[model samples]
Target: MDLLPRKGITDDEIGGQVARIIELATLEEKIAMMSGHGFFEQIRESGGRLSAHPYRAGGGCERLTVPALYFTDGPRGVARGNSTCFPCTMARGAAFDVDLERRIGEVMGIEARAQGCNFSGAVCVNLLRHPAWGRAQETYGEDPWHLGEMGAALATGIQAHNVVATVKHFALNSIENARFKIDVRIDPRTLREVYLPHFKRILDAGCASVMSAYNKMNGEYCGQNRELLTDILRGEWGFDGFVHSDWVLGVYRAYAAAAGLDVENPEPIHFGAELLAAVKSGAIEPQVIDTACRRILTTLYRFASAEDPLDNYSIDLVASPAHRAIAHEAALKSAVMLKNHGALPFDKIEVRLVAVAGRLAIIANTGDNGSSRVWPPYVVTALDGLKDYLGDAKVVFAGDEGDSDAAAETAKAADAAVVVVGYTARDEGEFIPGDMSGDVRVEVPQKSIGGDRDNLGLSPDQIALIKTIAAANPRTVVIVIAGSPVLMNEWIDDVPAVMQTFYAGMEGGRALAKLLFGEVSPSGKLPFTVPASASDLPFFDRDAESIEYGPYHGYTLLEKSGIRPAFAFGYGQSYARFGYRALKARRSRAGIVVSVSVINLGEVAADEIVQIYVGFPGRMVDRPKKLLRGFKRVSLIPGETATLRFEVPLDSLRWYDASAKSWRLEPGTHTIYAGSSSRDDDLLRREITL
Candidate 1:
């Protein structure tokens, strides 16, 4: 019997089938569909790894021909063995190319299906409230508008292959150290305006699943928060898909079923026998269990019954050459050039001996070693890529800062030098030993993986290395590998050129080589603001049990406080020069349409990200100075000009009124700024009345 997906099935018919299956299933069988199975055996087989393959979490019944939900984790790629590792989500966020993000999502979906996964927890849209958050690499960026656009694109691409795309961490899951116990205190207005908008945007884009966070919001665990899961998600937003817990300790009690949680992931510690007993003892109603099962079956059947876009699910498609090319493209587009004093785009003929310094240059430093880690077939390092790119020109390498003198001498003898430095998994990532709340039986062995970063700047040794290399060779380029923004005030002035390559994936080295050799121009922009000092940002305590989330962060906070950042939110330099002119804005039927003409004045072809920001110069209520409304990526050759237009929705300009408990559009004249970055000097402004 063929079990492939069928073509052209209606939603009503799928719902009827789900209802029939729920009615036919026994009480025990129905209970079995609420959580993961084979918890202990999976751990044993993988030797305690987070996710070795696609684990069947819940939902399947042979008696009713119901299919199980096979789950895989990622925002980079399929979190399984030998998968194509693309740039991290934060790195891709820097690209600001929705089309590129969608293409990457399609590749991820194809790979997930080939690995036998029906559900993908790959669309992580959690807001980056603070860069110190360990898992910052998993999210898109700080701006709600930007996050929503990038995440929605990925979700749309993934669902095209008939896989259920999950938008994750429900709400306010930024802090990573005390994630399981922290009670995030956020007001309704701040919650709606800042954090929850992105999640709502992804759901509106037709995403099929959600993963509840481990943290608490207003003193209630997100896995069991009725206000968040039921009232808002179901009643207000009308989301019909299922929601599962994060991982082993995601759900603490069986009564979470009534609280709106549908499935417990990677195990059934709380939702298995305890839930059965709760139902039998009248502690939990049968209706709750039935509702959860119905939702699960409906989503599973809907995806399983749809026709897959691909003809075959070959294992060879896991890390195919085509997918790797996308990864390489993402790496190339995501690299942000922070500074350059005419010391970049090294000429291969002029530079014969190139010296590569630092320890990270030789290692395959893709990303954190946590759950999102992808085991690509191979990873190219900087040394290997530079050596390959410059065949005749000799490339020399130097190890860590322990031998700073020797490294500096090597740089002094070479024509140019490239020093790679930055944080590793030990410095920051997803905290592994999560709080084993309630009565979980599995013993989670301690792994040296992740925690919130205490210091935002690089180590003393790295700072010294940068200064030393710069002193020895006037032409030295510094490459930083990190998940989030690193404070570089200490040694930034000493280096002639610097680039932030945030955990570039398997093809990162090749992209880096291309960028350095002028094969491609650097076009990626900074997704988050880089502050001159940590105090310029919001107050953060990674280990705090309780914290208050405010209405401002990133560039908004900087502008509101009248402080200057070392680099603006959307700031990045390209080898090719770009000039903006002819700024125009007009009211359309949808809302407002803003257009600007951009011309490439340099000698090479390149891409430029056109940013549109909306500012309320005069307003009744307190608000950020300006918020990012829309962005578009355009490509142009030397001396060529392109006119780009962005449609700003009327709804995007509304502000949440705490007293009315609804969104309000303040009537006033608004200013629209268009430019290459968020800096004031880079933008051209126009005024419009609503």
Candidate 2:
């Protein structure tokens, strides 16, 4: 009775068993397990729709009794039927609450498992190189440190339940439109310091897998780039997990196996028979195939054996009330109050007649329906939330169908006008074919479905509507519903108050109602810098097949060019005021500890994002004005004070030296700036030598 080979064992006992199982596995079984078998066929059978039903993507060996890995897309929520849709990753990043993100990860893991998915492809840490990057909403932010910390929290949370977490778009795969064809030529320093740090952080957290980017890095496809897949990821960083290709058109050549890609996902377009032929023709070694299979099998066994397999879970856990509450909490925390001129916290009795303008107010506007789509039981619209909250108070709605003048005339009678505006799935998301192709080689049905935005401004009609409403009603609050930053130069001055509620999850509307009525304070900060003008940011060409990536973007570029941002990164305001005082920095064994007392000065309770930036001494090479090293979100009640201590890791402060191809922390008098945002003048600084 050698039961070790049949029954599922614990993760600790999988090391020796993995080799034994691999030895028992034949060449066909190993190759079959290396890539996703019949993956695209399953999607095609399902009409290219994602559902709760399990679609085995990889790692099932009948001979070895290895369970298949059921994977799904994520970051917001599980990408399946009737799943709880949390706020977008950008929204979570704005919250700056790592603990909350971990909670989200835990719930995501539960739901993903409930949906019969054991592998979650959710940890999207691709840096937001530009705000216009269509899939900007999927990632955390532009800063490497912020993305790393946030992604690490998410990866850690997902793996807690024994679900495999996949950190994606391995190298620089920011651009959306030309992702399949673009060559991002970046300097070694920029690639190491900015582009790749977040992925490394996720790997350090022991993410189960890495999804190679579709784009080419320095003229080589990421899936087939040995320097990226083998040298950096596997060799240098010691990522032992299997590396999979992006869905559909991830790899173009079968020899990608030689490049260190362990799995070809969704389908075996480039793998399967082509890969078999290569191996038989001496183009690839059988040992390489064995290595790939072993990696995949080992990782799968580690996760599958750690807990009961996901297929046994009930579907009721997908969008449970508790899970929806997390969505509400995310929405509450993700809202960034851009401007408030005594117009927010709508008094129930005082503000009787409220006009909720724009079509977005009534729509169930979650986000893109590409890969991260979550079909909640019901979506709470802004109108629904307001109506639910303001029971006796009259909340009027002015649809976009009517004439602008008529809408404005109606708004004049209201005590205050709240206009909901901004983009949806039509404007941004994961770039896919208009036809939703099973194969990417086929031409896109139409123009870019999900690609980099051509512009960063609101629609002219929306601008006109806001201006009209502002002129009619002295009290007007503009709420922007977008995934990323939007330039507000056109009509920012017209509106009295402005809020950026990124595609907040299923309960976003309810959360919006709470923030508007002062039930909860607006606590979310800007994850990316809002440029005063789009021209101030880096050059972005979404359709360009090849481009050069610079070391600086977002706030770094704006600061370097001496251009002021419309709203700096990590900037957000609450209903109440917070004062930062008693700032001190001292070196500790862990690293430099920067402690500051944050006191809520206003009568209302609120939350504050304490951001710590290290101003590296200008010397050997050009550096960012200041880099975000650490941040924490602290909640405070009225008149309450808390001492926030942020540990400044010396390793994070190190700059990548191109000559040595290693990170070097220069010893100098570094200025530690503590503030609510990245604005230089707003920060309280103390000089310290490291």
lDDT of each: 0.89, 0.85
Find the candidate with the highest lDDT and give its number.
1
lDDT (Cα, 0-100) at 168 in candidate 2: 88
Best model number under TM-score: 1
Q: Could you report the Cα RMSD, in angstroms, for every candidate shown?
A: 1.7, 2.3
Candidate 1 achieves a global lDDT of 0.89
- For candidate 2, the TM-score is 0.96
lDDT of 1 by residue, 1-690 (tens): 222224667888777777877788888889889987775667667867756857887898766666798888898899877899999999999999999999988988898888888788899988988889999999988999999999999999988888889999998999998998999999988999899988899999999888999999999999999989999899878999999998866778888899999999877788878899999999999999999998888888788888877898788998999999999999999999999999899998888888999989999988777878888999989898888888635888955678877899989999999999998888888888743324555455644569899999999998888899889999999999999899999999998999999989999988999999899999999999998999998989999999999999999999989999999989999989999999999988778999999999999999999999999744578889889999999999999999998899999889988898788888888999999899999999999988
Residue pairs clashing, model 1: none
C-alpha TM-score for every candidate? 0.97, 0.96
